[model samples]
Target: MKIFEMLIPMTWEGLKVTMSVFAITLIVSLPLAIFVALLKGSKNKYIYKFTSAYIYVMRGTPLLLQLMFIFFGFHYIPVIGYAFTRYQAIYIAFILNYTAYFTEIIRGGINTIDIGQFEATKVLGMSKSFAFTRIILPQVMKNIIPSLGNEIITLVKDTSLVYILGVTDILKAAKSVSNTYSTFTPYIFVAFVYLGIIAIMTNILSSIESKFDYYR
Candidate 1:
């Protein structure tokens, strides 16, 4: 069979797996990150310390290693052992990893907001939480767009990492065809597909950032 003939359908099938992981991770992680960030910023020493350590561990480790542990290592942990399927393991790992990253991004963004905004809120008799939700967070979101854009693009590429669990993602599918046909065409084709996704993401993020231009 010609490489393209096999590669096309296989790549499409693989893309389905990749997009499912990516879409679900973003949906769950984005909001979860916000809640975690608030915990990380808490004045209660215990709460802050625990949240900080979790974020540190997640950020400090390699995501590939994390995925392996969740899928393989979890099987050794008493009752939860062998409880999750490969797909569920990947989802857990991806969501946990991205939530840590997005939390840190949000923290950095809140730091970048002008302190005077906080003072102004105080003058207006606003609670800190009220100010954060109604005022500060909106600007923090704008400030974090560039970082989020980069992370999101990285997520698209990282979807390929699911193959570590023997999940048939785009790169894995492409590899199967390449090995059979003895041609690099499958790899090149998937590279174009990846680039196309990143390009669309960049454009979407650019539009989102522009919408916040009035913040300045």
Candidate 2:
């Protein structure tokens, strides 16, 4: 309680920034992942290859590097330079990084489905897209929920990475308080705040997972 009294005012603005990054990344990346996953299976070689390369670049590289390259490095290039604002760059970088990961996760879920189902759809003379979108995608959503929850948990901490861009997130806010007070109290406060967030998130995810349990 004393810690909150000391830190909450100073850190409120930073918390807002952190939550915004997490929310936007999750909102945009989840749906975009489904689309990208479909493209990864596209019959057109070019589309499939392009998606593979994009995912490779995004997941193969450090997310911090992705943030730096977008916000700082891209500014040196013509046309692309000066295109996105700092805020936009932050969202874009986070979204792209998470989308690649989610895409692969979804693809993994898709692969876990039995091939016999695909054969069933073919035997029924149903189109591949229909079966995929209707019969397959929902089950994939259920299968991937736990995986997605794990990623979301990671994203909460990963939001701290934005401090590297001088975004004044909670970590940055804590650093300022720490410097001014010449104490580690601020970091302690920040850690508690993060734990509180993760605690709530864990509860919500458990509830979500339980809702799908009957299907199993």
Candidate 1 achieves a global lDDT of: 0.92
- In model 2, residue pairs whose N, Cα or C atoms come closer than 3 Å (at least 3 residues apart or on different chains), thus clashing, are none
Top lDDT prediction, candidate number: 1
Question: What TM-score does model 1 achieve against the real structure?
Answer: 0.95
Which lDDT tens digits does candidate 1 get at residues 21-77?
A: 999999999999999998988899999999999899999999999999998898899
Worst 10-residue lDDT window, candidate 2:
1-10
The lDDT values for all models are: 0.92, 0.89
Model 2, span 171-216: residue lDDT tens: 9989987887788989988999999999999999889878877546
Model 2 bad stretches (over 4 Å)? 1-6, 121-130
